[model samples]
Target chain A: MADLATFDVQSMNRVDLVTVSGRIDSSNAGQFDEILKGIVGKGRNNIVLEMNGVSYMSSAGLRALVSTLRTCKRNRGDLRLAAPSERVVDVLKLAGLNSMFSSYPDSVAAVGSF
Target chain B: MSQVEAVFPARFAEIARICALVQLEAAAAGFDEKEQFRLQLACDEACTNIIEHAYGGENRGNIRVLIRQRDGSFLIQLHDTGRPFDPSNFELESSRQPSADLAELQEGGWGLHFMHSIMDEVRFDFDMDQGNTLTMIKVHP
Candidate 1:
């Protein structure tokens, strides 16, 4: 069975660039949270999420993102979003979380923000 | 008017399938891409609430959904038989407010908030004989 979401992570000197593609809903949100936690657990706190391929995100997905963001910020680092789809941006706005994380238009900008 | 009904097992894995079904109906009802996306998110959160709160656990019960397109509005009624739950009891003030302080944030109630924000009308009704029903309506824009 093919997975509903996939995450590919590349570690940089100051940030971890994670390219994510697929739908993030209740079913796979736990998996998403675990993967992010794993990334932070390995002594990498700064994260740049490339979300060009994310087609959908529900409140459950937002929960995972919030949890990860809190963890990153606690370690004096941050989680930045790059190239989110329009739908994802709308969701973040509706959830009143658009101001929580700084968003960039592309991965280069997001990575450079760190 | 067009209508579609389906029963799904109350499991986390079934949320995407449910959303897909709603997406089809929403698109058929003349919802634009943005409205369809809102419907999908509302549907996803509603089903998740059923599985997690109404059923108390996954696979313990079933979620029956009815989608209807009528009179320039999209209507969704979700029925669950596991338990009677008043979702307002779990409402969090933080869900409606965006705060940068992590300590004051609450992650649980955003699902209900999303459902209410996306749908124009949201109502919950419970009957001893008919089970719990959550009816949500979105007016065509």
Candidate 2:
């Protein structure tokens, strides 16, 4: 299995910002999870997942997000979502996860939420 | 046996693009939009599970995807050398149940359930001899 894709994490103020682009599926979902784990490990609890460029997501991707949220909650931090494409948003809604995390139209608003 | 194989790193961005390709191929092969969507969803779930669970948090393996038309259905097989867990043995909870809390409905545990729900048949075979294989079928409706 080759590296499926890459993700970038940035920090702004108290927010741990993550920008994920590429397919999040069985092949790379674990890597995505590990990226999130690294962020959580830094003790920066307020998270904003910026998905404006994410073209697709699978249940595995959703799982990574959920797991990250759980981790943040355990640390008394919060995870927020931003700028998911229509297709990505549909999956979240279909899985009934739209309301599980706070979603903003873009990263600025998402980061501002904290 | 004519087959097509797509190889990509263990990343989410590529999964989305490949899923679109798979959906297009399924539709061109005469699957209705609804059926195509179902196949796409199932494939996405399977592939995503492999990415997250198989490689154990790294993009360091291959997810070999094979698709063929057989009998009156499209047969899809995903081959991965990840962990040896079987998806077939897992009990899929219903998606229709209303949850008392939003956290209970978070997105992590639905990959197997979604694949099982959408595909006509889903099977998993773990072979130390050959690796892990997940085979699924979707028939034209």
Candidate 3:
């Protein structure tokens, strides 16, 4: 799969902030899940996905987030969202998955929440 | 507007192209940015369902997509020569809603839910000649 989405991960003391930018669809959603799972595998379950740069996300992307969230919770950590665009938030709300993940206005607040 | 049709292999790689084409029609039909995103999301989920359920895998079949505009409605029809399936049944069979509870949320059922919620109308039909067809309509407001 091509890099329909790209991300840079910054490991904070209490959280790993991943700034993701691009379209997320069925084509690249598996890769997105793998990347997040890799971070969780490394014992960094507290994650904040900075998503203002994400222009689009489908159910496949949402599935990845759910799976990652479940894993994080099992490890006594969490996956949080930060600064998602209105479009992405609409999709999140449409799928009724918005409440599963906490949203922060900025990465600083997201990291502080952890 | 006249109906526009395109056929592509039932592969995950082709979903983006299929969605981009339909989005062009939706944009030309004067749908707003939010509506365009909704149309795109619905189309993406529909195609994903076809690939995963109807064809059962990628490269197993082809998907025929038809988009048309009439009155204030945008119509999207997806035809696949795979299996006879009903999307509503999938929704009915799944007892899970991801939003209902965080601890028990699962990932497999959101595609059909999004298609129904985002689109004004969603219907499924199966025919001997048509195989399986999923129709979705969005009204421009």
* lDDT digits (tens) for residues B1-141 of candidate 1: 999999999898888888888989998888888988899899889889888878888999889999999999899999999688765674553247666677577776788888888999888888888889999999988
Q: In model 1, what lDDT does residue B89 have?
A: 74
Error of 3 at B109 (Å): 0.9
- Kindly report which residue stretches of model 1 are placed more than 4 angstroms away from their true locations once superposed: A1-3, B87-95
Clashing pairs in 1: none
lDDT of each: 0.87, 0.75, 0.86
Instruction: Give Cα distance to truth, residue B42, candidate 1, Å.
Output: 0.4
Which residue pairs clash within candidate 3?
none
- Model 3 CA lDDT for position B70: 92
How would you encode candidate 2's per-residue C-alpha lDDT over B30-102 as one tens digit per residue?
8876566668778877776777777775476888888887667788888888888654445544334435464
Which ten-residue region of model 1 chain A has the weakest summed lDDT? A1-10
Chain B TM-score by candidate, in order shown: 0.92, 0.83, 0.92
Look at candidate 1 and tell me the lDDT of residue A20. 89
For model 3 chain B, give the 10-residue run with minimal summed lDDT.
B93-102
